[model samples]
Target chain A: MLRELADILQAEELCNTQGDNVQIDIACACDLMSDVLLHAKAQCLLLTGLTTTQSVYTAEVADIKVICFVRGKRPQRDVVELATNKNIILLATHLPMFESCGKLYRNGIKGCSEV
Target chain B: MSEDTTAQVLTAGRVQELVYELKIEDAMVRDVQTVNVESTMDDVRAILREQKISGTPVLCRGELVGIVSIEDLLKALAGGETKTLVREKMSPNVVTLYADEPLVHALNQFARYRYGRFPIIDRKTKKLVGILTKGDIVRCLLRRLEMNHQARERAHYRPGHLFEDVVSDKSTLVLRHRVEGSNFQRAGEASSRLKKNLLSLGLSPDTVRRIAIASYEAEMNIVIFTQGGELVATIEPNQVTIRASDKGPGIPDVELAMQPGYSTAPDWVRELGFGAGMGLPNIKKNTNEMSLDSKVGEGTNLRFTVYTTNPT
Candidate 1:
């Protein structure tokens, strides 16, 4: 399911490739770290435009396993290293947030609130 | 047990421990009002009205003999026996608690025997030492909790004062990180390192997550707002305390800033996917206790504590 979701978004895996076989049924798209902390649940896939180290820390705090940076935003080297050290899967997609979320929703990936 | 029942039990766990820790003498009224055994029912009624008490123990020549209650007095008055002696109407078999017994024993006695009050007696001297009512227990517990809170407040102000009294070898991990203003790239490094350290310390995942979230928000605030600040986390055996202090351009109105949707952040910070005005609220939500102190033209110091023993 994770590999299929990544394909639909045309995302490139940046770190933690072992999580490619993992299943992700719930997804939340947000750039704000506080909103993700407030609303996101554990094991959900995160889609955001922010590619700073804060994003990786937010995912680690909220227990989000995978993060996909939309709008073709690639995080710096240190951010990717941090994600790898945290064992969180990182993906970068060229599609914008709207298109990325739409593609995932079309392929049976439900939003966190919907599920 | 169901989750709800388990939560209820855990919520009452502090009071349960308090009852076992306190002695009956600590909460009992030391000066007990008494009436002589030979006193008449009219005298008992007057004593009850004057003392504002529902019951009084009857003493005979410096010895506790029985207890005269408002119910006994009312019964005598209705039966036209208002002149009856206190001994004639008093219940001779009085249930009493020993002064040295734990307060939990008194609680059990109160639950088992539906009495409104219990006379406490000294075990060695066999003398009535005090009287205990349900009100006394409630007041005692409340006072003790207040004292504990005050002590914790004092410790918070002094930071490491709680560890001073410990002669035994205790490991306290101190983590300090400095932040630079407007540095978005390294905003969460402090909290990230803190999370790893806490996980290595074998703290529960829930507690570690809470501390991490709180510290991350504090760290981001320093990065986005002030000229920079220092975040210090002191990890103890039972709790963790975090202090974030900045240098200049302090907030004028902290109460307004604490609101959920209020933000003074510039457009650049907002463009970085932060400053939605939920950072402080998120910090408050994750930590068990939080305090913010700021003075205009001075600086802001935000401190918070997360209790490991009781994860909220």
Candidate 2:
């Protein structure tokens, strides 16, 4: 499902990670880091549009394994380095928030509530 | 049936006019990835791998010295030469495109040579401004045809429609930014300033964020592509109007360019995380109204407006 999600999002891998073979149970998308920090489910795929290094920091604190930057929002090299050092998988996609979630949902991926 | 032909003829004529008018400067990929002449073969290979590109222009100082391809690297690797510098082995004789040349010149070159890419150098400066590939030409042509049609239809657009033509020169707070082409490091300075001004005016946080993002993305576009330009922000009591105008070729396909992930920026820019093709779309999405006016060879003019809740 991670591999399939990568294809569906046209995602580019930023570093060696837990590997794309891991199944993604829930997906949470938002641009605000505070919202993610407050509400994210553990081990969920975090989708965001903010490219700040703080996004990686927030994800690290929230215990998310994978962070996908949707709408073609590429984070800075320093941010990627931050995520890489923290052992978080970083993926970038050209898909907008609605459609990215739509594709994943249509493919049977669930929201954070299910988790 | 006759009416359809008439509409098609008008569109075709407009497209042809645009094709002849559009030049290479506007659509070429700026912020090119290059290997320094003194760089080691290993360094070149690392750059190629990191950027996911096959070849890159080699530079001595700031001038383009040559172009080195993956084949060059492969041959060197196959011969067990692992430590040679790029200057010793790069192809000195390189083909280049002048920014002022018509778009067809590049199309002909692509058809004739079928080269993967050609470096675009500024005529007076002889400095590398961008790189062009066959894909850029095809993308430009297809997008230009459709966008040119749209541009013609938008000929009568006026920004005053939103502001009721009530702007007073003394009351409007005007800000200007000078953006240098391919200057990635200093891209967001203007946007930062604009954000500060917006916040100082007591605008809502949501409104401030949208305006800041739009201004920053537009500022990035100018920095990433263009021969330096000025961004003018005219702030009124109720709205902030940002107009970005630059020197050089203008955008050929405003619609396609506004699409997310449709970036023509070089891979190196993408490597740094700026060229996601989300700049224009995000700007459009964040603003209440957006308009683009570009001349093929002359330049580009982009204007977007964000309504302020804290209108004083």
* Winning model by lDDT: 1
Poorest lDDT segment (10 consecutive residues) of candidate 2 chain B: B155-164
Which regions of candidate 2 deviate over 4 angstroms?
A1-115, B1-170
Q: Look at candidate 2 and give me any clashing residue pairs.
A: none
Second chain TM-score per prediction?
Answer: 0.49, 0.45
Could you give candidate 2's per-residue lDDT for residues A18-86 as a string of tens digits? 775777878898775434544566678888887766466555545577899889888778778767876
Which tens-of-lDDT digit does each residue in A9-98 have in candidate 1? 999999884655788998999988889987787789999999888889889877788999999999999999989988899999999999
TM-score of chain B of 1: 0.49
Measured on C-alpha atoms, candidate 1 has an lDDT of 0.86
What's the C-alpha lDDT at position B156 in model 1? Answer: 59
The window of 10 residues in a row where model 1 chain B has the poorest summed lDDT is: B2-11
lDDT of each: 0.86, 0.75
Please give the clash total of every predicted structure, in order: 0, 0
In model 2, state the lDDT of residue A38. Answer: 41
Q: What is the interface RMSD of candidate 2, in Å?
A: 9.3
Using Cα atoms, each model's DockQ against the true complex is 0.39, 0.02
Candidate 1 lDDT, B156-268, residue by residue in tens: 55533434444458767678889888788878878888887777666778888889888988888998888999999988878999999999688888889999989898988
